[model samples]
Every structure is written in structure tokens, then in C-alpha cells.
Target chain A: MKSLLSVQSHVAHGYVGGRAATFPLQYLGWDVDNINTVNFSNHTGYGHFQGSAIPEPELIKLFQGLNQIGCSYDVVVLGYIPSAELIDVVASEVAALKKSNPSTRYVCDTVMGDQGHLYVNNSCVDAYRKLLSTKIADVITPNQFELELLYGKPIDSEKLLRDAIAYMHDTYGVDHVVISSLDASVLNLQELQLICCAVSSRFKERSQEQSQLQVFLVPEIKSYFTGVGDLFTALLADKLFTNNGNLVLAVNQVLTIMSNVLKLTHQLGIKEFTQHYGEDSCERLAEGRMNDGESMRFFELRIIQAREFYDYSGAGEFSAIEISN
Target chain B: MHRNLLSILSHVCHGYVGNRACVFPLQCCGWDVDTVHTTNYLNHPGHGTFQGEKNDGRTISTIIEGLKKLFDLREYYNVVLVGYCPSAEVMTAVYEELEPIYKTKDRKEGPVFVVDPVLGDNGRLYVPEEVVQVHIDFLKRGLVDLTTPNQFEMELLTDTKFLSWNDVKSACYKFYDTYKVPDFVILSVLIDEQMYSVGFSASTETVFYVPIQEIRCRFSGCGDIFTALLTNEFYSNGRVLSPQVLTLVVDKLHRILLTSFREERARLGRDPDVIHDINLVRLRDLFERSFGGDLEVKYL
Candidate 1:
């Protein structure tokens, strides 16, 4: 069965490994495994809260138990985590998990620092660095800042981007890397952002000049809601697994999915503010629940990114462009 | 608590929009999709009463300010606000100042704002790019109680392009996962994405195949009217159910828009590039009759 293991936690109910990460994967038909490392009453962003964290060994035990089940996982998604201890344990567990089920694809949502700042300690960040520097994960998604922090330098020019990708693959054993919320060329970069993505895996033919990078440009979407990374990574994993581990198809699909959501939020004029709106009642709340009653076809997806999925080898092999824009 | 109904509407007579929504909602709960000539686009800027250019899209801030001024909104408790067309922004703005007055603060029902995504008709974005983000930001903040985004809008929100049930479910649930806004709705189900083979008008016996990209039927502004009526039926009627009932309402709106499309073709004479009915709708059929209650299952 497909499962998602969210490592992060916060006191906020709306964000984090809570409803934000767990429910979507569950609704996506996966037998979601929610392994929250830190469980506060709410997200940490809303200030201090009283809660404890799950130690690395304790957390590893659960995944190890799953390994004992002998059923290979189709996909494994990792989100925010607590201490460096958890990260170290996670890296080892992930490595072992991959060794056992080599076919199992792991997607790491490297949520080091959020929209504003990093929520964890230096030890935790270092753990992510080490975890990422190994072959434990097949895919890594980090926002611009997270990429910078991981690389120990700002990701400004294209050289840095290419170098970063090479570094990730060579040093960390990362197969695929996606850096999000980039203002790469735009002057008002913060408002209008993009995602610089690269894919390199044993599953595909590799090329020296493939660059393995493409920019996922999206209109400006604003907000302070935590766990958007959880949502993005969850959808990405769902798409990746559903598409059967074709990284290009999966990443391309993720871009379209979130872009569509952003477009809808814009078209409908959904404002960025926290308050109960519309005809809110306990009755109305039920309509949003995840059930067959709530299921429906989402939208007409136009595959605009098919041409930009960069997977190639230097075998001098003639290849028809995957798609034409 | 004088329960007043607030509706934000615009875009009255485009080939994609219509004028019957007021009647439909008026028939059910006496609320309307408020109207004006402009999409608030294409007008010279700087006029407070009505300042945007025609195609530029009226600022949500402008529309919200207009709503506050028009309603003199400070006097009410437990207001049911249903917004459509260019009014999604208006619904969001009101939420900031409106929620505290009611919402158990005074043991009253505060302003309940429902936003109907009005980005496209027949599946296309009619507004500017910035507007899409503004709307998403609003929904992300939990300002929208009930959101009626079409199938296309759902893809836009979740960033999925070619989606089946799994992708669609992932996209829909992402709203809850990220923003924690519990009220997200996908309006209709097209029997086929190609729209080429599926879209039909049986009454007129018109079997015009929709182009692959342009498969959706041309309905002017039914979205604005649908969201308005559904929100009113939800908040104004004081219904106490779970989020389950919204799918029923969303399904009904889809069919209502279909029926509205046929009606528009009849009214506007199938103008190929455009249709007649946008704002006008038949609300009772959706909420009161509940679209035969079990009808939405056929598509699922």
C-alpha cells in the first residue's frame, strides 16, 4: 500500500503534519502513515506550545516495523522533523528502507526554513544536510532559502543552480531536486515566484548538458499558512507514485496541479485572511469532508510542461522532443 | 441580529455571462447577484464610485470598499454574504471587519462569506493573472466559508493538469492540508475532458462538438449566481449539516449551469463565440429540489 510519513509537527491544527499533510494523502487512497516527530497543540509559528517530540529510535521503530511487514512500499513521503537525532535516525531508516525495497521511491520535502525563517535548530538542519547528502532519498523538494542553507551559499545565478544540482547528486546521493519559491529573474521576485527543478536518477538516461533544470513559473500567491509544503509534497508524491515513478511526469503534474489551485484561488478572489466565511455552520463544514460525497473531477489539465521535462543521456542518441509547446 | 444578505456581483451581459441569477436566487431566498456594466475592467482609474478599466479586472480592494460603502455594513450581526463574479475579493475584505461582530463574540452569527470562483466561463480565466493569486490567498487564509471552484479551478488550485480521481482528490484535499480552509468545492463534472464529444444541447438538438480545449459550454456568468444562491441557501436558511451537503449543492450548480446554458442558447441564439445567460439562474432546482439528490452520482 502507498503511504506518507510526515516527519514535521507543530501546535497548529490547520497546518503541519496534522490535517494539512495527512488528510490529502489519505484521500488520495493511500494508507497514509502519519509519523509526526513533534506533536504540539498547534503549529510553532503561533508561538510557544507545550508538546514533546518522538525520538529517532522510536520513530525508526515504526518504519522498521513496516519493513518487517515484507510488503514493499510503492511510495514514501517525508515532511518536517524535529531534532538532529530524528534526522540521523530518519536517514539511516530511509537508507535501510531503500536497500530493502529498492523500487520504493522516497520524496523528501526539505522544509528547513519556511516562508520567513527556519523552525528547527542547527542540529536539525545539519541532519537534513547529512540525510540529503546521501542516497537515502530519490527526490528532494526545497524552497529557495532551504536550498541556499543546504548549499551553504545563496542560489542566485544559473552556475550556482547547476553546481548545486551536481553537488546534491554527487555528494548527497539525491536523485531529483526541486527548489521552490524562487524569484530568479523577476524584479519583484518575492511576489511573482518560480520553481527551479532538476531530475537525475538511475531510472533514466543521463546527459551532461541536460542541465536537469526547468523553471516552474507561477503567478504571485500570498499567505502565512503553515504546511503548504506538506500539501505540495503530498500532491507531488501522490502524483509521482500514481504515475509509477516517472519523475518528469510526476513533477510536471505537480506544477499543473498547484498552478490550477492558485489560478482558482485567484479567479474566485479567495482572500488571504483567517476567519470563518460564507454560510458557515456546523452543517456547511461537513461539505468539505473527504468522502465519496465530496469527490469530483478537478479540472481540464493542459500539459504545458511536457517539453521541459529534462531527462536525457549523452549517448548521442537521437530523441524526439517529449512534447512540443 | 438583523440577518441581511450581502451579494457581490458584476459582469452582466457578456457572451459568457447572463442575467437570470437574480431571479433564481430571488425565487429561493430573495438574494441577488448584484450587477454592473464593467467586469470593472476597461475603465479609467481614479473614480471611487466605479473606477477600473474594462479588461484590467476591478481591484478586489476596490470592490470590497464598494461593498462596505453600499451596505453601510457596520450595523448588522450574522450577515450571510454570497459573492460572485468580480466580487470574490469583496467577500474577503468584509471578513476582516465583519467576523468579530458576530461569530460568538456577541453570541450572534457573524458575516458568513462564501466565494464562488469566477475565473472562467466554459473553462478559461477571464481575469488577469494577479487576480487568481489574490483569490487563492483569500481562500488560503480561511476567509472563504464555502468555495465553488469548477473542475478547472480545482486543478488550478492543486497545480494538477492531467488528473484522474486520485489527482483530483489530492488537489481538493490540498486546500485543507495547506490553508486549513475547510470549504472547498468543485462545481461540475464533464462527462469527458475533451468536451468535444460530450457537451450537448438536447432541447435544441444541437450536437455541436466542443473543441478539445474549448469543450465547455458557453455560459456567461452562472458561477456568480450559483455561489450566491448556494451560500444564501446555506447561511441564510440556517442549515446545520456537515460539509457533505456542499457536494450536492455543487452538483446542482453544475447542472443548473448546463440548464442555464441551454436557456442561454435559446435566449441568445447560439452565438458560437458567446452565449447569453451569465448571472441569471434557476436556484430552487439546485437547493430546494436538490437536483434530484442522487443525480450527482451519475458523473462520479
Candidate 2:
């Protein structure tokens, strides 16, 4: 069985961070070991949550214990560290793991924020930049905002986006870079169409001069959902590893599964809202008038219900469009 | 509709035990699990060298309070499952937080409380002595609806020295009568080289024994996994302790253990005594499948 170490946030009451990532990876047949960066009552999008961030020392102690037990993994997936110090710890620990076993793959999800909002500490961007410069991560799944943050500039144009992707490949030495989701406005696409892009530098080792880039256009679900990014990163990591570094197949497979999960979540969320507060409440929800607690309820991912799709081997609804640079 | 469960247990980074063993299976069975970790260890200690720290009572209280503050425990959770409290203080914190919910309503209206009194096994005590006392005190308060204890813990709970099956029955009766706990299941009892899970319900006045197939190898998280499966089955069966639930839990556990045993043998070659980590991820199909087994439950 494949083993992975998952470093992320853990919400006791909801599926985000490790809670979202761990089960799907496990169902995909990976033994996942999780180190929770923060233990929260629920995701922060709820507007009111209670829990404490795990101190840096505690994080070190957990990693030290793993080291003492001689625990290594086939993959190490990093997501949602709250501060720069914690990210530093994760970087060092992952670096050590890679140094010890040169074959260990690292999947880094630069989880700073989404849609121009930064939820984590600002220093985390610099921390991630430093970490990526070390050339330790094998694959990185970042959103448009995070990609721009790592590139240290705004990627408002297609040219800038390609430059950023190339910079990540050439400078950070990352073999696989997947822009998990690009804002429709960034690419001037239809609002209903979500763009996902994957780039692979693994072909370079075969003496191929150019890297392969694949872009996927998938229909968007209008409803808001949390944990989508975490789940996507996890599935992408597993599929990339299982499919033997096939970026297009991995991204296509992940997007297909994610589309199914979001649709289920939306359907269930509507059913629950109508049952609780009648049909009119959904209009209020769509208008963004619901209170934070009620609004958060509508966004909880239907992870358990959508378990069957985790191992989807069938053809995906969306196919990648190869783009040459 | 899926039921909600509050699982208080240990969290390990490496292997399946405590919440790691319980959460995935319960979630796969269509339950939403909210966990409060009492300890965080790198792996199960059976590996001989482990690293982690035991959480204090304050941490437990803080998390539980956070849950209670945000959501109504009575409405949100259908079951409260407790396992593997590392310290007596942590156990006390759990009891203190949960006692109020039990105090407000009876078991029928409130969440069902299931405690796997994880003290020790094989005639030993792995936890501190104070932990045992706290468990006894919690039981005496009539707070738990059901508890699954092994033969060794059953002995400690009832303060009995069992030489025969009758002694075990009497201890069960003592537990029901004295603690007012409605149901109890002795996880494993070895009688005549055969293992059986003996379940008793005070409400139904029923006693049944579900035989467990003896796998040659030992495992670290079997008991934890068994308790999780039992909790899921028990709720699915309308909160009844019957021969059917026991049979399903034992059968599923049997398949998982047997698979783990076979895999270990294949990997390590016939090392019968080595304790193996049951790969629940590999057994995902087994968990998702509807529970079925041909094992017969013998009524006592």
C-alpha cells in the first residue's frame, strides 16, 4: 500500500483541510498520516469558530516522533499552514524527508487564500516562496491568487500567467504544477466555465525541449463550498502518482470527481435548507443574506456521500486542451 | 439522513487507532463524526518507541465547550463515543462536559453514550491507576448508555475474579444492576480456545454470544475498530443490542483481521506473533459493503 504524510488544518466539526483530504486519499488506497496544523471546531468561513493553532514546538515534537519511529512515506502532501513559522517547520521537515529518501514525492498546495483574499498570515507568502526555492516539492496545486503570490506579481494577462508557470518550473524545480482553479475573469472566460490548468516538466528529463501544458474547462457550480481545494490537491496527488506522472489524466480525473462532489453538496444543501426554512430561504441564501452560521452550513462538502466517485475510472466529462508555449 | 457522532479518542499520525480507526469507517457508513482528541501520538505504542503528548483536561474542556457553544449537542449528535483517554484528568473532563447533556434528558431523547473503557488487555493495565478510578466513577454516575470492555476491564469494573462463564454473567448482572448502564458488551472472552463477544442488554433481558474467528496474529487497533463498527451497527439497528448487530460487527472485523493477517504473512512470512497494523485503507471495499456473515449467534 502507498503511504502519505498529510500536513494540514483539522476541523473537528467539518470537512476542510486534513478532514477533507485524508478520507479521499485513503479510499484511493493510500495510508495517510495526518499532522493537524490547527484543531478548530469548524472551518473559519463559519465566521465564528473555536480552537487553537498548534504551536511550532508541538509541530516539531510530532515530526520528531515520526523520525524516531523511522516513519517515511511514498508521498508528503502539505496544505493550509496558518503561519510562516509553521510553514518553515513543514519545509524543513519535508526537506529532511526528501533528503533521507530521495524518492519521496512532495505535493505542496499553496493555501494562502482565494479570490483576492488572504486568510493566513502575510509572511506565509514569503515563507512559501523560500520553501519553493529549495526545489523540494514534486507537485504544487495552487489557485490563481497563490500562483501570482509565488510569482511576486499580478498575473492579469495570459502572457504573465505563462511566465509565472515557467518561472515556477525553472526556478523552483517543481516537476508538476497544477493551477487547481483559475478565476474566470483572469482568462476572460464565461462566468459559468471554471478553468483548471496542469503543466508538466517531467517530460524535460526525456530530452524534450518544451514542457507540456493542459487546460480544462469545466462547468461551475454556483453554490459556495469549502474544502474543494484540499480535496482536489489530495486526489491530484494520488492520481499523479498512480498514473505515473500523467498530469492531464490526473487533473481530468480530479476535476470530474470534484464536479460530482460539489453538485451533490449543492443538492443536499438545498434540500436541507428547504426542509429547515422552507423553499424561500434558498433565494435568501443565493442573495448572500443568510447569517454566517446558516451560510456555512450550505457550503459543507458532501464528502461522505460522494465516496463512490473517489476512484472514478470512467471517462471524464471534461477533456484537457493542450497548449504549447 | 446521516446521523452525527461525537467521538472522543486518541489521534495518531501513523497508524489506525482511536479516532483514526473510528472516524473513516463511521463516516463511510454515513455518519458525520466530530472528534475531540485526548492524545496525539506518532503511532501506536505497540511498536515499542512512540512520540507524542497527552492532552490535558483543559484542552478537552475547551474543545467540548467550543462544540457546545456552536451547536446544540442534543440535536446535533446522535451518539457520543469515548475511547482511549490518556490521563484521568482528560477522562474527568469528558465526563464533566457530557454529564450535563445526560442530566437534561434521558437516553431516548438525548445522544446515546458509548464508552470503550480502554484501560488494558491480557490481564494488565496500560494506563494509570487513576484512569481506572475515573472510569468507575463515570460509570457509577449512570452517565453511559453502553460500554464495550474486554474481559480484563470487565474484571476490573466489577471487582470480580472470573473462573467460569457463570461468573462473567454475574458480573454483567452486577454491572447492569449497580451502574444502571442499559447495555454492555464484553469484547472478547476466551473460553476453550475459542473467542466470543458476549453482549447483554438490561432493557431486553437478552444475552447472546457472537463467536469471533481466531486469527493467528495480534493487532493493535482491533478493539478500537470493533467498538466503532459496533457503534455504527447499534445505531442502524434502532439502538438495540441484539445478536444480529454483534454478528455483523464480528464478521466485518474478522474479514479485516484475516486480510491483515494474510497480508502480513505474505510480506513477513509466517510470523504468527507479530502485531500488525490492519490496513483499513486497503479494506475500504470491505467497509463500504453491506455487512453480511453466516456466523451463528449462540444464546446464553
Candidate 3:
């Protein structure tokens, strides 16, 4: 059995993101342990309320305790680090883990940016770049503005988004980069809006050639709940762990599950703002995309773009692995 | 002093089961629920065979007493009380009982009243005309701090058609002049007229006419979310908000709806799972987040 570890802001039964990310990992039958960075009373849906944050040292200690228990996760999904210190702690953890388990990879949900601006603390962007980008975070998921912040330029189109995604994948030495919530067509916002995109740079490492970039657009999902990014990373990590690390197939499987769940939400007439983040919502998703290890409908996603690579090495091989439970 | 907002509803859980059962997202922000009192008659606390069976005043009063005891006017300052659905009658009663206590004792901050007047939608009163009558009386007697009604509900209250932004403004002004409710929020409106103004009562006479930006699809509980957020914006800003500021809250809600639609499509028409995290009351923060969008606020 493969295990995955995810970190984000969890408010027990309160908010959607932490749990949204957490449950899907579990639903897919992966043993997932989540480390909450902050536990707000709930997802700041209520106007004013209170909660607490978990310190980085304590989080490190928690992982250490898990190690003592012989519980090593096959994948680690990191999201919304509340502080620069936590990012530092996570970077160190990723490095150490990768050393021991070369196959295990880190997926970073770069949640520091929102709408069209940066929302994370000013001190943390460099931490994300240096600590997360260089040494760890095999996969980095940043929305459009986040990509611009990382590249220090405006990403006006999908082409620009792809460029930024490729830049982070190569410069940071990460093979998988996903940019979400971007519009390819500015003139028509609706037609252009996409949920999320996965830009692949596997061949870039083998050749001096530019890495192959692929974009997987997540259907445009409202930022209603908190931990969706966390959930996406966890599912990808699990699929990769179970599948010899075939990032493409893994991305497809996870997307299928998310898309199916989103469709169910609409059928029920639930409001657009609050997408049921409760445990019950997971029950609706109670069933996972199954294919008897052959084929899954949700696994069939539209691949919007693919790039070619010739000479790329440190970037590693482009392989889609799927390890089934 | 700590303050809180309570969202009360009176409706057949089954009638709007989809709306009420999953309403927790609208009720609790910060995952905190002051109280949820469900009655049958969307606006009346204890009447009807509500939920289709009612006329039980004692059972309803007991619930009211329970709510009253849970929140003490003496302890909280600036507590805002909001009532929607068939529960408005009881909400009106709740306010009547609590208002004097809040005023005479001056112990806690005065409770702010925001009445959504859920009597109409899409320019027509959906509830029984009598139920709408109760709300009209509630507003006429001057019982709320702010009132928000869609074009239809506003017209039902004041009997006017919003032919243009100017017309909407005149009707709103007439309601205010006639009824004395200062802050009247027209929930969602679209116009082809000149997009002349931008945001807030930048100044009262300069009333801004923010040409509404249209985001498609209407899911349930929009009115509930709107009132909750608007009340927060109005009250938190010392009850004096720039019309443009409301755009931020409205925009977030619009996005949430769109996102939910995306999730729904992914799930084959299923509701988005994020609905679980929604508390009707905290919708304000959801819409007010730094990244949130704003309503195109404007006035005549």
C-alpha cells in the first residue's frame, strides 16, 4: 500500500480546502496523513472568527514521530505554507526524504498568489523559490498571477503561462508544473477560463532542447473551499507512487475524480459559492473512478498542449507511472 | 466586547431541503453557528402546518426563548440579527423583544437589523402575499438598520418598476423617504442604460450607479448570501459603506457560483463539494477576501 502526506490549513470539519484535499486522497484508497499549517475556526467564510497555526518545529517533530512509527509516506503534497519558517522546514524535509527515497517526489501548491496579485507574506516568495523550487518540490502548482510573480512578468496568455510553467520546471529542477485559473482568451473571459494546467518538462532535462510542456486545464473551479490544491497534489502523488511515477496518467486520474465530483455538486443545486466541503460531500464522491486496472473514463482527459524535448538531463525522464492499490 | 451575527430561517426543510439541509455553508462563517431555528412558514416563526403542519405557538416560543437565552444583549456589542424565509414573522418578534433591551440597558451594543424581505424574486413575490404583508409592516414600522430587496421585492414594498437606474434610484429614494430606512441595497440588477457611475454612495447625492457585471447561472440561497455579506459590509464600516465596496463582496459570490458550476459540471451536474465549507453567514468574508471581486456600484 502506498501512502501520501499532505500539508495545508485545516479547520477540523470547518473549512473546505484542507478537507477537500484530504478526503479525495483517502477516497482513492490511499493512506494519507495531513499536517495542518493553520486551523482556523473555519474557512474564513464567517466574517470574523479565530483559530490557531501549527508551528514549523512542531510539524517537523510530528513527521519525526511518524518515522519512528515506521510510517513513511510515498508522496508529500505541500500547500499554503503559513510562514516562511514552515517553508524552510518543509524544504529540509523534502530534501531528506528524497535522499532516502529517490522515487518519492514533492508537489508544491504555490498558493501565495490570488486573482491577479500576490497574497502571501512578502518574505515567503523567495523562500518558495530558493527552498521549494531549487532543492525540492518536484511539482509546483501556481495560478496565473503566481507564475508572473515567480517570473517577474505579466502572463497575458496561455502561451505565457506555458513559458512560466516551463521556466519553473527547469530552473527549479522540478519536472511537473501546473498553472491554474488562467484565461487563454482575454477578449472572451468565459471561453478562455480554465480550471488548472499541468506543464510537463520531462524531455528538457535530457536535452539542451526545451523541455516538453503540457497543459492540463482544470475546469474553472471557484475558490469556494480551501484545500482543493492540496487534494489535487495528494491524488497526483498517490497515483505517481502507485504507478511508477507516470505523471500524465496520474494527472488524468485525479482530474477525473475532481470533475465527476464537481458535476455531482451542480446536479444537487448547491450554491455556487460553497461547494459542500463537508465529509458528506466526500460520500457523494464515495465512489472512485475504477477500471479494473485497465481503463477509466475520468482518466480520459483532453490534452491541450504538448512540447518536444531532445537534450535534457537533470530534468529527468518523462514517464507516466500508475501504481494501483 | 465580542459580537456575532445570527441567521434564522423558517421553511420546510424538505421544501427547500436542498437549500436548508446544505445551508450550513451560509449559516456559519468561521464554522461558528450562533443558532439555526427552522420553522415551516418561511417567515413566520411558529405557524402553519409549517413544514406543512403548524399553528404551534408554544413549541415555537420555546425555541425563541432558547435563542434569547443563548445570546444575551447585555454581553455583546453590535450584534446583528438577520431573518429570512418563512421565519421573518418570528424574526420580527425576536427583534421586537430584543430591541428595547439593547436600547434601554445600553449594556451591549445595539443590535443591527438587516431584513432581506425574501418576499419576492425576479420581480415577483414568491411567498404568500400575506407573508409579504408582514414584511412590509416590519419595514414600515422602521424595524431594520438596512434592507435589501431585489428589484421585484423593492417594487412589491414600494410599488414601483425600475425602468432605468434613475427609476431604480427614485424608487429606492421613495422607499427611504417614505419608510426612513437609510441603507437599502438592491441585491442584483442588470441594465443596458449608460454605465454612468462607479461604486458606493461616494457621496449621497452623487449616488453611484455601478453598471452590473453579469455572471450567469442562478443557484439557490443567493439572496441569503447577499444579505449576510451586505449586512457585514454595512455594519462593519460603521453602517456607512462606499457603494463600490459592495462590489468586492458581490464579485466573490459571483465567482463562487461560477466555480461551483465548474465543479458541478465536472461531477455531471452534482453540487460542488466545497458547499460543505460554506456558512451562510460568512459569505461576506468569502466575497470580501483580498482577491474578491466587487459589485459595479453606482447611483443616479
Q: What is the C-alpha lDDT profile of model 2 across B16-38, one tens digit per residue?
A: 88999998888778788888898
Pairs of colliding residues, candidate 2: none
**Which DockQ value does candidate 2 get?**
0.72
Tens-place lDDT per residue, model 1, B1-300, is 113444434321111222224323432442322222223221111111222223112333343333443233434313344344444344345444444433443222345555565565445776556557767775665444556667677667667653454454455456556554444445454434532111111122221221222325544454555555456556644532123344445455566666656665677676334443332322233434544433222111
lDDT of 1: 0.48
Candidates in order have lDDT scores of 0.48, 0.84, 0.52
Distance from true location, Cα of B127 in model 1, Å: 58
For candidate 3, lDDT tens digit of each residue in A236-315? Answer: 66666565656666666666655554454433323321243453544333343222111111121111000001011122
Model 1: how far is A115 from its true place, Å?
6.2
Candidate 2: where are CA atoms >4 Å away?
A190-208, A221-223
Which candidate order results from sorting by lDDT in descending order?
A: 2, 3, 1
- lDDT for position A33 in model 2: 93
A best-first ranking of the candidates according to their DockQ comes to 2, 1, 3
**B1-300 in candidate 3: lDDT tens per residue?**
123444444433211222232233333222222333334322122122221222133433444444443335444325444455444445456555545654553312466666666675775555556677667665676556677677677777778876676776777667876676656667665556432222223236344545444544455655565565566666657766566456655665566566656655666675443332222222323432555454444346
Evaluate residue B162 in candidate 1 and report its C-alpha lDDT on the 0 to 100 scale: 31
- The digit string of per-residue lDDT tens for model 2 on A217-258 reads 877645367888999899988888888887787788888898
State model 3's lDDT.
Answer: 0.52
